[model samples]
Target: MKRDKISVVGFMGSGKTTIGLLLANFLNYFFYDLDEYIEKKEGKSIKDIFADYGEEHFRNLESFYLKELIEKHNKIVISTGGGIIKREINRKLLKEKTFVVFLDGSFEVFMNRLEGTEEKDKRPLMSLGKDELYNLWISRKPLYEEVATLKINVDSKTPYQIVREILDFYGKM
Candidate 1:
């Protein structure tokens, strides 16, 4: 069976937004970035939400909006926040509602993607030092793996290449 919705999951810098955009363009589906959606709906940037309301509040909002999106949308490609898999309810929803793909990359690759960018500083979790970031990545990786219907290792792949791989794999399915 072909799922109407595809959810892209990964740690930060794993190219979820970039690849999801390309994949949606290729598939002629609507593309959504979960964080951007949340930000728009809340009328605040994610950084502002984190700063003012904290992560727990942001997470609750995330769950609410994700459920809303799943219930309301179809033929869409969703690029999810890195920590979306941290919640069991979100995991259950993702597993049951969407064809989820996990995009994985090495720590070095993640760092490289994030390097020399002021935008990177706006991410709430970016306050962590190098070791902490690596530890967080390691911890979250297994969760991503557990929820994924398909897993793509994106160590050296460009966004277009990743989209192509996803399209090919999705076609085979």
Candidate 2:
């Protein structure tokens, strides 16, 4: 592929950050975690951003950084926030500018990974109940699929394994 960027998109707890770091290192690419980027730029934690402003403001930040990074960088692996794919502009930009990968997983896997973690509450949408979260997942899955160049089921995979799979799928192997 000629694409210089690899954008990882998926639901929360889908291991996008871990796998993105591993894949970037394996490919000798720079790695950018969008959430961390937003936090740094805004001088606040994601939880604080949502609490102080609202989800709308936080999402605007996500869209801004998503576009900025794609426009400004190359040969970088970007780990996007779960809801980043919700915006049509982001969807188009990611699909066109990068090899987008959707890390698919079951709700059980997502909940298990999130359970007992400090980072759980930092996710603005993590406050939802199982049904609400499930509905959100259902709604977003198609959007993720829409923009993805590759999709990997991550339910039983470790970070290293996921990286290898992505590498193979991306034809880097």
Candidate 3:
């Protein structure tokens, strides 16, 4: 594969940021956590953005920044926000422009990963509680699978293991 961008996509708390940093470092590429980039660009937290402007507005901002990154960078590893796939434009970009790695983990896994963590608090969706978050995960799983160039079950792997898995597979490609 002609490696340009590798995007790690999954629900919140699936280790996208952790593994993305490792992947970028291993490959000597720039790393951009989409959420962090958006936060920095907006001069506020995502939690605050969702609180102040609501989901629709947040989604628009998400789509805009996503396009900017896709267009502006090639040698990059982007850890996209969970809700990014909600937009068809974003999905098309991922499917066409980048090698997407779907971190496939069950709802239980996701819940366990985020429970009582700072990630759980920062995510506006998680504040809706388990049922809502689970539903969101369920809905997005197929979308992630649809765009994924590779899917790795993340139930029991350490960040290092997952990063190695990605690197090994990407190298072969």
Candidate 4:
């Protein structure tokens, strides 16, 4: 329960990077957006990765980098890509190694958060259409639940409120 590494997992628009940055700043810990890290490591956008290689290759890179970060860092906050949970090994690693926070929110809420945002276009799976993405959420919801150490409903809460809630829980544990 007292994990130093906190990994935030959720749908694409679930504020993982934003909240993870705040949480890490508040705690004076290292913050890594896994996607950004991947982009830097591979020298290309994730969309390019998907287009050049494939989702399978991307997932492999995601999993490999995830493990590298987990093993190398202790006091850290990780904002994971939405599809990281698609792999069983990634799920197990997160569940066992980090204080995994599943930022729970409805599909509509997530879509609204991301709507009209330029960054939305950068996501490979965004091309799959709303219905498919919603189904992806449906299928992955339980996987997030299964790996979460603390599940935070992000629908109605402000970012500050969510951070406070996580800090409060961290303090208790």
Candidate 5:
């Protein structure tokens, strides 16, 4: 099916935001990072939201924001939060409204990219150690795959290369 918009989804550190920006520029579409949108709407940092309201509350807000965004935007590329696919409704909305791409990356690569980052406190999920992170990856991988129209492995690729891959996959190149 043809789509007017694109939505990029992936685990944390998978370059969804970075590659989404480049892809949106190439496609000349507006770019929306859902997490950043939520942060703006809530008037608080994601870290603060997680600390104050907890993950469930934050997720509820995320769902609300995503629905509003999809309802109101077109010809845009949206980068969704890693856990966005956890909800079936979000998955259906994304599938109906946009071309969904899963940017897949290995856990080691993700850890390497995320290492020493100050954003850890803001991302409660990343507070886990290596083993727990791996477990999280294992559990979430299937959900990411299940909802994606296209899956691009980003293990060793640059953001630009990933954008190229996405364009190729979407037959837009």
Candidate 6:
């Protein structure tokens, strides 16, 4: 299949946003971060949305935004939120519109990257501590794998390296 767009999904702190931007730039395509899109549309940060309306409401908005974005863009790179794979509808839309790349990473690396950050405020799932976080990752891993067309281990890679790997793997480099 000829890929016109690419969707990057992974756990929080897996560098989806960073690598998505790099990949978009590398391919000369537009870049969209789903969380940022939601924030812009709602006139509120994701942290505030989660605080006031809760995760379910936030996810609804995210789905809406993602659908709109997919319809509007042709050549683009999207960095989806960590929990995007939870919804089967989201997975279906992604599969139809783009090649989904799962950024696979270790729980220890994720913990190290997320350390000292206020991610819990913006990402509700990260509120759980190390053990709980690891468990959550374990549970979500299968869902990510199920929808992924490509999987890349990002535990010890730089953003540029990951982008290079994605391009190479996709035969776009």
Which candidate number maximizes TM-score? 4
What's each prediction's clash count? 0, 0, 1, 0, 0, 0
lDDT of 4 at 151: 95
Two-way lDDT contest, 2 vs 6, winner: 2
Note the Cα lDDT for every prediction shown: 0.91, 0.91, 0.90, 0.95, 0.86, 0.88
Global fold similarity of model 2 (TM-score): 0.96
Instruction: Report the poorest 10 consecutive residues by lDDT, candidate 6.
Output: 118-127
Candidate 2 lDDT over residue span 17-60, tens digit each: 99899999999999999999999999999999999999999989
In order of appearance, the predictions have TM-scores of: 0.97, 0.96, 0.96, 0.98, 0.94, 0.93
Q: Write the per-residue lDDT of candidate 3 for residues 39-101, one digit (tens) a residue.
A: 999999999999999989999999999889989998999999988899898999899989999
lDDT of 1 by residue, 57-119 (tens): 999999999998888999999999999999999998998899999999898998888898875
Lowest summed-lDDT stretch of 10 residues in model 1? Answer: 113-122
Model 6, span 2-23: residue lDDT tens: 3878999999989889999999
Task: Name the runs in model 6 displaced over 4 angstroms.
Answer: 118-121
Which candidate, 2 or 6, has the higher TM-score? 2
Order of candidates by TM-score, top first? 4, 1, 3, 2, 5, 6
Better of 2 and 4 by lDDT: 4
RMSD (Cα, Å) for all candidates, in order, is: 1.0, 1.3, 1.1, 0.7, 1.5, 1.6
Q: Give the per-residue lDDT of model 5 (tens digit) for 1-173.
A: 64768899988988888989999999899999998999999999887898899988988998899989888988889999988988888888888778899999888888788778775556778877879878888888998888788999999888888888888878852
Q: In lDDT terms, which candidate is top?
A: 4
lDDT of 4 by residue, 1-173 (tens): 64799999999899999999999999999999999999999999999999999999999999999999999998999999999999999999999999999999999999998889998889989888889999999999999999999999999999999999999998989
